[model samples]
Target: MIPFRFLHAADLHLDSRFAGLAHLPAAVRSYLRESTFAALGRLICLAIKENVDFVVISGDIYDVSDASLQGQLRFQEALKELGEQGIPVFLIHGNHDPLDGPRLVAEMPEHVTVFGGDAPGYATAHRRRDGQEVAIVSGISYPTAKVTANTAVTFSRKPGSELFHIALLHGNVDGDLQHETYSPCSRKDLIGQGFDYWALGHIHKRSILYEKPYIVYPGNIQGRSVKETGPKGCYVVDVRENGEAALQFHELDIVRWQVTELSIDGMEHEAQWVEAVERRIEDIREADPHLMTVVRFRLTGRGNVHRLLAEKGAAADLLSELQRREALRAERKEYPGLVWTEGFAVESGLAVDRSRLLQEDSFLGEMLRLAEKGEGEGSREELEDIISSAIAPLMENRELRRLLSQVSEEEKLDWLRGAAELGITLLSGLEGAGEAEGGFRDKPDGGRYDED
Candidate 1:
């Protein structure tokens, strides 16, 4: 066995649109458009700096099924850079960029090996100094966008090979419900294959499923949306003389996604609210320092600030102020120091005593009692029925149906809770019904994007 090193990355998602972010400023939107490309460049630079023997990308080199010309060109250019450095790249196409889909004509460099879809293809990495065989890479690409068959089972190790074996696959393992269950397979299906490492893709969040043989998912090179948060990057695996592999993660994302909750419990004045949010933003900047962070802030806890936030245009005004401040900060810095505000979810509530209100015999008391009844009885079915009825019209509208289709059951339940809270706030006379803004209201199937 020969000692070697390689970089493992998956889910490049090149030329991502960063959709549903048109509400941001032109400067931020323009930066986001190039972030995916920047992340890819960073990955290639990392591979060169690490001086890895080879690079393996499990799947999803492009964002769409029909790979875009721009994405293919950018990917080709990056691969050429690696090829110039004498580093070989073995890549496979996942569900996002299947082989059967249309792609622009961009010839790959000699050092790049794109695995075929018919069966698992094999590529061997050799030492540049003496041409000694080091590692064997086996991978398969998706024949079409929908790969229902267990693609992992198609791979079989070369019998009695002394070189380290690495399998690159893109599929759901053990039925992870978070992503589309394409090419589904179990852990038992992957283990005991004589492979030294399993390089996987498709699920964006990184995880190490096993240790002895090193089953790893390096995740996407960039965070495409707020749902995919934290540091996004690839792994550099070092194969020692003893045939044992060691893995190290290196972040390559240019723009990071962050979700945070800020309590407005003690704040009585609007200035305090602004200062508190500013402090949180500063904390996030201090942590990331180099990368631009897109934050989804949730305002929680009971306070007088909720009363103010419930007023028309109050939250929007605050958001604008924050955006302006960050934009100015970015203008001053030579590098990316900006923390773009994606929007705020005001989950804060009034300071009224719900228990005290429940004891009264007024219309507001009856409403509170009914809310308690619904909550205590676990009226999930009833809430679902109400939500479905309210959203039925929105579903009928072809324009909004696509957006509403992503609403999860958890989100629907959250909306029901928000509706109950808003009803109580209105009935309690904390804010005038006429003054209550649509942005503050709990909209069925459209809660997260009520803000601009």
Candidate 2:
């Protein structure tokens, strides 16, 4: 029986432009630009530190359309770093970087083994620590960019020995709408293959499908967009001869992109709002001491500043205040670390639980009732779509296709509550109009009067 360790990482998506983030502070932008390389460096460093038997990168080494030569060269350097440690790198071309890949000018290292061809390819490597054969890894590179067939169908048929059989695949196991469903397969398709472990890529969020055979998706090495908020990194898997493998995740992102929501409830003045936001920046700096941070603030809950926030230039003023705070930090030589406030939104309403209005029998109550329709299972998803598409054009960030994913999580997608308050604002603007709900609205999210 042989025991070994390996690093499973995927969806490098290197040389990404990281578009839609230009408005962030220059320092944050610069850190983000270099964050991918830093993350990859961390992965290599970990492999070297753990003396892993081998490293497997499932797919999407670089973006085919936007990949740069510099990105390729840097990638080569990282692989070379791993190669120097006698760490065999097993990689496959994902949809982003197909077999007939872009950025072909860069040279790959000799120690790196890329599984090519449409058919699943098998490669075997011995443990660097011992001479014994460690594991047989199987992988298939996407020949072309637009592969629609089930790539896993080939995995079931791929040949491998009894020793820890690991399969590297870059495809959607199920019908996940978030990403392009290339090389589609099923969880049953993977677990049923009897492979000792499956390192999956293509999806950006980390997930573990099953444990018996050890199927995993390490997610992207770096968080490239706001939708990719939270800690982003790779996983280290340790396998024993005849036991369940132990897995640990390590954070490798150089910067953290977080959306911090502040409640202005009980606050009285504009100065209080600035002071509160400043405190949040300080808190983030304390928590993520070394890493740069880009934050998008959302004001929620009952507040005196609701109308102030809704003003045309209110968001701009808040942005300036944050920038001024950063400048003061630099002047006073305080945490000089980079913590930036990119943008913000106002979701707060009158100092009242608007749901109570829904139960009323008046015009405003009727509006609340109609707005609450989307909260139910019958109309929630429909309403979500309508709001997302309607305001999709007004959004400053164009990377995300939907509003909900960009703004908040599923459980907290209660922006509908704020919609009720906004309806009141619109209704007030309508000069006592009995009813409202028509005409074009250019504001982000939705129209105020269109609600109540």
Candidate 3:
């Protein structure tokens, strides 16, 4: 076998609207809306720059099954450029863009080969230099959006082919819980097949499930949400003549998503909060000076700032001020890149001395003890029941019911933490009011009214 190389990418998710982020500024929103397309452009540029023999997109060419005309036109134009460069592209349709879905009126370039859903399709890639056949590409597309059957069993390596074989698939491996269990198949099922490389999709986090005959998922080219953070990109696989393949990852995302934390442990005033947050934003911009960043700030730890944050609209004011500052900088072109604040979360508590309170045999102590107990492993089931009961009415709404079903246990625990902190702060405030009025004193159980 001769040495060859190819670009392996998946989950382009073009035309992603970046849902759940509708509150962003018009300029930032527009940038996010076109981020996926910009990622596609970067991918095309990388392919041409590397001068690879071919390109393999495992699945999910569009964000939705019924892809938009604009997305299709842009995609076709990019592929046409690849065709002009004499580079072939082999791709498959995942659940997001299945074969049965509606599509644009335009046709794909001749150099592109889209695998069908009837069976595992096959193609041969020829090196443009000498026109020598290098490798065999095989894949299958989803017939519809919801595929419940195990599609991996249907694939078999070609008979008597000495060429390097790459298999493309878009399905859950062994029922990966992170993603929907569509076209479920086990890693054993894939490994048993004699294919040289497995170009996978569906799950949008990159992973190399196996090596030797490499099984890989290049993740999505662009992150559509904050949950999918960090650098998003593709892989360039260089196959040595001896069949040992080397992989190089490249970042293609234009706009980045991040969740940053700011500790208010020693903070004494509101101005300090503003300065600290601004510093964190500057650090993010400096780290990636070229890319635009959308960050969610989380303020943590017990401090005086926590009491300020407890005030109605305090957190909102802080977030607004930060946003206004950044917007002004952007307008004046003060910074080389933009760092937009997505939202702020004040997960802090009142700066009370917990040790003294915990020692007292009063209502405040009991409350603190119970809050600690709630964080233990044994309390999870009870906490779940309590939280579910509290939110039962909200869950009764059809949309909210469906949305709540998708909320993870970890996120629910965060809500519990925030609630506990708020309860503590409110109780502490009442204690302060009682002392200042000289109307009450701490009793064994709780506060008591003083005798005249």
Candidate 4:
């Protein structure tokens, strides 16, 4: 009936280069580069503050490609600090930091217990104040980078073990659209294993897969790209004397990647458009005066702004004005700064009504139908092929390749939607539907790259 606490975290991705964003400002890049380590520092600080019995790191401690000594040394120092505080660290190596990973060059501190790569490792932590056994955490590290098996099914409660049981692992349970199926297990497989808690890694977004005997994914400590938005961090868990468990999340991401949609339906002039966008930018900077923020935007809804946004070079001009404004504010020290737009997409539908036009068998109606056919025609793959062929010329750029590497399908779809909007605008102009608005949106999918 002993009560205890532990911090569960995963996917440190230490020293990982912020992908899909090779063109951010130097100051922003510098902050992003150190964000993963900072997240670790925050985790360590939280551990000390909570006086947790131990800490559990599911996996992916560091990106294997970034074999920087700074990351290694920083990791060593942080664990050493926890050791000095008499707190134990239990961790497993995920695919990104497999036992054979090239980036893992440093030794762990004495207080850290890393589950072996060959098999699942076991450890028991004793409460610092009372010296009573709080729990036994079982973990399995990846022997190599790609392990595909139900690793969870391989575990069983220790022989007559009389303590709380926790399991640590790095794998895909069932399947994930956002990630590869590595070391795959099943939810039922994990739950039936009789482990009191499962601290998982690999997947970057947090999810509570089960209750009672808790199965949780703590997600990554820091978001590396636009695909990873919102809060990112670790979980603090308390196992009460009656074995009732509770979890609370702490934010560790120093830079938050976010996307917001703005409606430009009411604006009639260019000045109004600029004012509306500048106001939103102000709101973003005010969101957190303390931390840096990278944002992407989706300008949605049916409005004249959609036609303007479809014009060439319009998106860049908009972003430039925003950047200039940011610089002015920062120079005058009028605002506590640290915000920039990574990219944006214009998904606005055409402002003109086509319901009556579609009643006639006209070219405009056919164009509109074809443009939206992907929504129902099962022609998405076909359209993707056409789009890919058209944009292949731009893909030759190395920077473009790297930028798209971390982009998710969901984000990519935003660009495709913008393309459809542009098509609608072009067709409207051709049909003598008056002057099209010059407003434009930019997407990372070759929409508009920031030149500044």
Q: After the best TM-score superposition of candidate 2, give how far the Cα of residue 109 lies from its true spot, in angstroms.
A: 3.3
Give one clash count per candidate, in the order shown: 0, 1, 0, 5
Candidate 4 local lDDT, residue 208 = 91
* TM, every model: 0.80, 0.81, 0.80, 0.80
Could you give the candidate ranking by lDDT, starting with the highest?
A: 1, 3, 4, 2
Quote the lDDT for 435 in model 2.
23
For 1-452, candidate 4 gives per-residue lDDT tens digits of: 69999999999988886554455545455666888898899999999998898999998888773457888888888899999999999999888777776655457777889999776778888898988988988999987888887787788888888799999989988676578778888898988888899999988888898887898998999887666778999999999988878999999888787778777775555677668777887788787876667677776666655556665446668887666655454455433356777655665555666665455476766655654654445776866664566568878999776555555555556666665556555666543223433343333444432210
Residue 15 local lDDT, model 1: 81
What residue runs in model 4 are displaced by over 4 Å at the alpha carbon? 20-22, 103-107, 324-337, 354-452
Q: Give the Cα-based TM-score of candidate 4 against the true structure.
A: 0.80
For each candidate, the alpha-carbon lDDT, in order, equals 0.81, 0.73, 0.80, 0.75
lDDT string for model 1 (1-452, tens) is 77989999999888886655556666676677788899999998998898898999999988888877888888888988988888889999999899988987656778899999999988888865566789889999998998999988888887777789999999998776578889999888889666789999998999999987788889998887767889999999999999888899999998898779888887788889889888898898888888899887878777777777777557778778888887776566523657877777777776778788889899878766765654556777766676777789889888578656667767776776667677776778765432433332221123332110
* RMSD of candidate 3 to true structure, Å: 10.0
- Rate residue 94 of model 1 by lDDT: 95
Task: State the lDDT of candidate 3 residue by residue for 1-452, as single tens digits.
Answer: 89998999999988875654445556556677888899999999999999899999988898888998988888998898899999999999999999889997656778899999989988999887888999999999999998888888888888888999999999988665668888889889898888899999998888898896798989999877656778899999999899889999999998787778788888888888878888898899899888888787767777776666666456667678778877776566543468887666656665777787777788877766766666787898867776787799999799788768877788787777766666666676543311111111122123221110
> What is candidate 2's CA lDDT for residue 289?
81
